[model samples]
Structure formats: structure tokens, C-alpha cells
Target: MKSNRGRRRDMQIAADNGDRLSKLPNDLLLNILERVGTLDAVRTCILSRQMLKLPTMLSQIVIDLSLRDLVRMNGVVADVTDKILSARSPQITIHKLKVKFLLSPSRCLSIGKSVARAMATQKLDAAEFEILTPRDFQNCTEAYLLLFAAQLNNFLHACPDAFAGLTRLHLQNMRFAELDITNILITCKRLESLCFVECDAGICSVLNVEHARLVEFTIAFGEFKTVELSYLPKLQRMTYNYWPCDDNPLVLGFVPQLSELNLTNAGLSDKTLELSQLLANVHTVRDLYLNFHSEKIWVRPECSWVLAPVLAQLRTVNLDNLPEECDFAWTMFFLEAAQCLEELCFTVWDHKCCRESQKSFSKKTDVKWEPSSIHFKHKNLCKLTIYGFQSDKNFTSYIRRTMKTAVNIQEISLHDRKVCKICAEKFPQMEARPSSYPRTDEEKDSLRKKIAAKPTMVASPAMIHFPS
Candidate 1:
């Protein structure tokens, strides 16, 4: 057996290390608790008498439980969350309170008041609540939605004036009406940022956002007839997943401070879409992104559509889905207009037009890349990136024009579109479809040599990159 003296020495060493942890200042100990995450920190309260009260003093609390845990625990998780929230000391100011939990009608009824009580007591800088939908969203009943909305409304109503100081609020995957949205915004008087994703607005035709302190906003996958931005003077960045092409268009009012705008699935038509009218007052935009779609070609001069306002402040532009069948001049209009543009990117995809037989690469093109204004040359242009490059005539013509006009160009990158691997093996048996894979390095080199030879080339030492 080990000697009694050796056992005493070993115990003394372990005691010294335990004392080091226990003797740490409460502030330093709290920092350690915060870094380990809320759940683990809360469990630390059981370590010793000193740790029992440490969780109550945390500056932030995050209650994150996935759907699997909720289903397996069968409502015990809600009880635990309630206990944790109830145990927090009111004097402790939480900087962030993030809760991501699966929601059901029954769970909402059980834990709604507990969550509201916690929110009302805490002074938070940022708050995010994500209510995950049921796995069978399509089969969800209307009664379930009614209960969920009722619980959420009650929680918002319980929010005290302390919630008004919240700087950011992100709500996702919930069905809320216009009244709920308005009430939440009005309650959070100092909210600077707001984001909503895949939220259903019940029977609401218009989402009128009239906030003074709000700066950034984003929305995706929602049904609303009109989104009216009226009195937002401090708004800076705005992103919409898809351009609003409903019966009524977005109303622009007093966004003089707006700088960046991004929209996916945009249209080039002036008849069905009112994008031109929407951009009338947005003259201060510096960065713009538009990903276009639709099979119909845009008639160039016949349509009489021009991007409103000479974007003197515009610096960066990203254009996607500019296919060969579409009017290439539509893109040229921006390059000619935005004289101060420093960076430009074009992304091509196979979703729009598909063919079986791959066409031979070409460097020569008949179309001219003439600027709308005779004196315009991209003096500030430095970088150009193109994805899904096939060395087609349209792209070759566009690049040739860019090389000639963008005198200060420094870098050019090319990426080929990716094809599904399994589908390629069956290409011979099937009808001709656009190959999803990029060109081989040898093929890319050949195309590069052909095009590099022809651009009565500008003298800048520009490097070309062809990434597989």
C-alpha cells in the first residue's frame, strides 16, 4: 500500500490547485463563467457555495435548446429555463439575451409568462428570438398559429420601458401580423437594427415602417402588398431577398441617408415591375447589388428604361444572371453611367438557359462596347471578377470592351459554373443540358491565350486567375 505520508502530500497539492480556483476574484470568476456558455455556467452553481450565486450575476444569458432536446425532455427544458430566469439577480444587467427554441402551442402557454418576466427584468442591448417551425410545416393547423401569436403578443406586452433601449432585434420563422410588428417597433424606441426571415404576416397588406432611430433593416420570404418606408431619416443599409413585384410597390420617403441597397431576383422590365420608380429618391447609394431573373428579353431602346439619377457616389456593383439572350446593353448602361466605379463583378449561372452541345470558344465578337457618354472611361476601375465563364461571344465582347475602356484595370478573375457530378455520366443518354462543371485548366489556358492576344491591350500589368 502507498505510504500515508505520500497520500497526504498528494492531497495537499490538489488542495492548493482548488484553492487557486476558489481564491480568484469574483469578477474574474464571472468572466470565466460567461466564456463557458450560459448552460454550463448555470450548472457551475452546484460546484460549491461560492459558485451558487455566480450564475445570478452573469452579464449575459443565452437559452439555446434545439428541437431534438425539446422533444426528448417533454417540457422539462421549459421548467429549467424558467428556474434559471427566476434565479437571476435584478441588479445584473444582461448585455445580450438570445433564445432559440422550438415552439408549439402547448409549450408557448407553459413558458410564455416565464420568458416575458425574464425579458422585463433584464436590461439588454441586443435580443434575438427564433421560433422554429414544426417539422411538418405544411400540416400545421390554424389553431396552433392562433395560440403561438397570442403567446408572443402577451410576451411583447409584458416588455417594460427597459426594452426600449434595445439596439438590435432579430425575429425569424414566426407568423405575426402587421399590428404585432408595429407594436414591437413602437415599444423598442431605440432599436437601430431589425431583421426578419421567413415570417408570415397574417392578412396584412401593408407593412408601414416609420421609425426615427432605426438604421438597418432586412426582410426575406414574406407576403406583403406594400412596404412603406416613410419617416426613417437615419436608415443606412437595406436588403430585400426579392424585389417587391406585388400589386403595390415599395414607397420611398425621406431616406436621404441611405447608402447600400441589395435585392435578389430583380427584373429589368418597366411595365410589370416598378424598380425604376423605387430608385428615384435613392441618389446617395454607393454600393448596389442586383441578381436578375426571367426568361423574356428586355427591349433596349424600345422600353425607354434608364436607371434614374447619375450615380456619382456609386463605387461597387454586382450583377448576376445577365444571360446572352438578355440585352447586354442593360449592363453597359451602368458601366457608362457610374464613372467612378472601382470594382465590378458579374456572376453567370445555368438556371436561365441550358443547351446540350457546348459551343466552341470565341474571342472575336461583332457587338460594340460603346459608352453612352463619349468622354466616359473607367479611370477608377481596378478589379473585375466573373463566375461561370464559358468564353462565349457575349462575355468575350463584354470583356474586350472592359479591357479597352477600363484603362486602370489591375486584376481579373474567372470561375466556371459547377455541374452536378451524377448528371454528367448520363449526359449522352439524355438531351443536351448545360454542363455544370468548370472548364479544364488546359481549356482555360487556351481561351485565355486567345482573348489576351486580341484586347489591343492596356499597358497595366494585370494578372488573370482562372479558378476551377
Candidate 2:
């Protein structure tokens, strides 16, 4: 045992000597240090002389503090920031700092001040500050807004030069009005991607995005009325949403080079022709999504007259719950007009009124229902998906007729509410299947045998497959 202990100590000493002799390159050591957090990277400096210089080579830094850490430690925020700044080399560029402050107003302000101080010395590429609190801003007083504005001013002052090189900006749940956002956009010359969530600003405040390089923009309004998107020249993708408001029409215009457009709950009256008119002007758009949540979405016979010309250029169309009897003639007209149509998606609401109307049509109409008439045959059409299929006699008959007409359709997908056992047994490989159906007898028997063979099987849930 004495001899073994002496041998072990000698081997450890030899390994230490080898490590000291074989020093890693600075670039390689920095790469290893970059994998760790800012705190860990700074901690590594105490390991050895070579590692003491590792933190200085760090180009990227991330700082995250827990809510408890903010409250427990008196000057931890300042101390950490000082250490990071001391270790940062002037040659290092592209610093990313992320701080999560979940504490009282005073503490948050202090942390913000420390971050601002750090930004003054470091060449920060991007700075993200997130405040995760459950405080509702709706009932907030003027005092709260003033405090927020002061904090934001401090943050901005700290990183005055930070935004000069920033190409992407994402601000979420920050209490700000339209004017503040417009000012920020003006300063951010190279801003490419901007996202604003749950921000309220008045209608007259036009969101003028003058950044010529702006590519993607997303804005969500909670209680704002009237939005204009006319000034963005280089904008490519845009998502605009508005809450229900009776005061003004959510106006959307401009973006000539836009390839993708998404509109959710756009407060347009059922009788209004503005939506059709807006669609008419977006001639350069290749992909379009329009979701209407109004109770009345009936399309008049003349709807095709207005919509057909605009939709003719669309490659993809997603229509959600238009009026059930929304002029089938107009539907046919739009389908026929969309010459470049590749994929078609249909979502129907299973309403009692719609079912009753279909029944009434079956009783009164003597005209033969041709399957080919319903089958949308576009030369480019290859894929068709139908949702809300309720496996009723009328629906099944319509499917059969429609399938016969889709000559170019290579793939068909259906999401049925209820599955037919017979159909599941017959067409297991088909793209269309009922949602609820029993597994094959062989599978059931196999599961039963496994359960009987092992008592542990009873403790586990059985696997089941159901089509959607």
C-alpha cells in the first residue's frame, strides 16, 4: 500500500508537468471558454495563468440573473458587471448581453444602471433586457409610465452606440406608445427584423419604417385603432394583427415587394368591400392569408367579380369559415380564375344552421349534383387538404364526386371528425381516413398477449393509433 501511494503521487506530478509543458493555443482556449456562461468564463481565470487571459478573448457574453439572486445579493449585479468589463479586451468586438431582472423597481433600475455602465466600455453587438412580471399595464398609473420611461432612457443612454451596428431588434411587452417606436425605428438605420408584441399606440401615429434594408416586420396591437404600413420600401414579410374595435377600420396598405402577408381578426364589416379592394392592390404577393372572425361572412354573388381578378395570381389560398351557403357559383368562379393555384385548403364550421340548409337544398333542388363541377382542376393543382369533414351522407357523396374531378391531384388529405370503421378497414393506405376507428384485430390480439405475458404491462398505458 505504501509503494502504491508513492507511485500514484509520482504519476499525478508527471501529468501536471505535461499539462504545463503542452500549452493550448489562445484561439483554441477561447473557443472552449465561449461555450460557458459569463460567470463560468470569468471563474475559469483562477484555474491557471493561461486561463487568466481567456475571459479577455471572449467576443460574446451572456449575463442572466435569477429573481432571488437580485434580492439576496446587495451589490452582486454591480460586482459581476465590473468584473466582466475589467476582463473584456478593447480588441474584442460583437458582445451580446442578456439580463433578466425580476425584482422591485429600485433593484431593476440599479441592474439597468450597471448594464448601462458596462455598455459604455464594451463594444456590444446586441443588448436584450427582459422584465418578467405579472403586473398588468392596463390599470397602470401615469407614475408607472414615467418610471418606465426613465428606465428606458437610462438603458438607451448606456448603449447609445449599440444600435449603430444592430441589424435585428425584438422588443416584447415593453410599455411604449407609437411615437417612441417611430423614434427608435428612425435611429436604427440597418434594422432588418423588428417585432413588437402587446404594444398600444393611437391610430394617427403612422409606423413609418424608413429603413431601406428592413426585411421582416411583425406588429401586434392590443387596443389600438387604425394602422398604416405604407412607407416600408424594402419590406418582404409582414404580420399585422388588431383587436376588435368599432371606432376605425384597420387599414393595411403599401409594401410593394412583399411576398408573404398574414392578417388575423381584421375588423372588417361583412358588407364592407375594403378587404376585396385591399386584395386587389397586393398584386405582387405570392402567398396570402386572411382570417375573418365575424359572425356574418356571407359572400355575395358578385364576390367573384371583385375577388377573382386578384386571386387569379395567388399560388396558395386559406379560407376559414366563410358563410356556408356563400354562393357556390362564386366559389366555382374563384377556383376557375386562380390559374396558378397549387394547393387548396378548406375549413368549414360544423354548424346546425349549415347542416339544416344543406338538408333543405337536398330536398328542393332537382338539378343533378355533378362531382366534376366541385372538383377544382387547376393545371398547377397537385395537393388538396379538407378539414372539418363530418362523414355525413352529403359530405361523403361530395368527397366521392370531388375526388373523381381532381385529375391532377397526386395527394389528398382529409381531417375527419368521425372515422368510419369500414373505410378504415378498406382504405388503410389512403390519405383520407376517419379520426375514430378501432385498430386492426391482429394489433389488439398482440397487445392482449403481451399484457398476459408480463404483469408489468398492466402498469403501463396501451398504445393506440387514431387518424386525424
Model 2: ten consecutive residues of lowest lDDT: 361-370
- Residues 137-165 of candidate 2 have per-residue lDDT tens digits of 56545455445544554555554444434
lDDT of 1 by residue, 1-468 (tens): 779999999999987877676578899998888887677777766766767777777787676667676566536656666776688877778787665555555664445556567667765556655556554335545565545566567656654343465566666555676588888788878788888765556544577888888899888755565677888899999887643454544677888888888766433334344445666677788888776542222212212125535376788988765543443544656666676788898776534233222331111112223455555577888888887776677676667667777888888887776444544553444443454333676766666665567646663323667766
TM-score against native, each model: 0.72, 0.59
Q: Which runs in model 1 stand beyond 4 Å of their true positions?
A: 1-37, 40-60, 64-93, 103-123, 135-137, 140-147, 159-166, 172-178, 198-204, 266-275, 293-310, 321-329, 351-375, 419-445, 459-461
Model 1: which residue pairs collide? 356-432, 356-433, 418-436, 419-436, 419-437
Residue 83 lDDT, candidate 2, scale 0-100? 61
Which candidate wins on TM-score?
1
Q: How many residue pairs clash in each candidate?
A: 5, 1
Give candidate 2's TM-score. Answer: 0.59
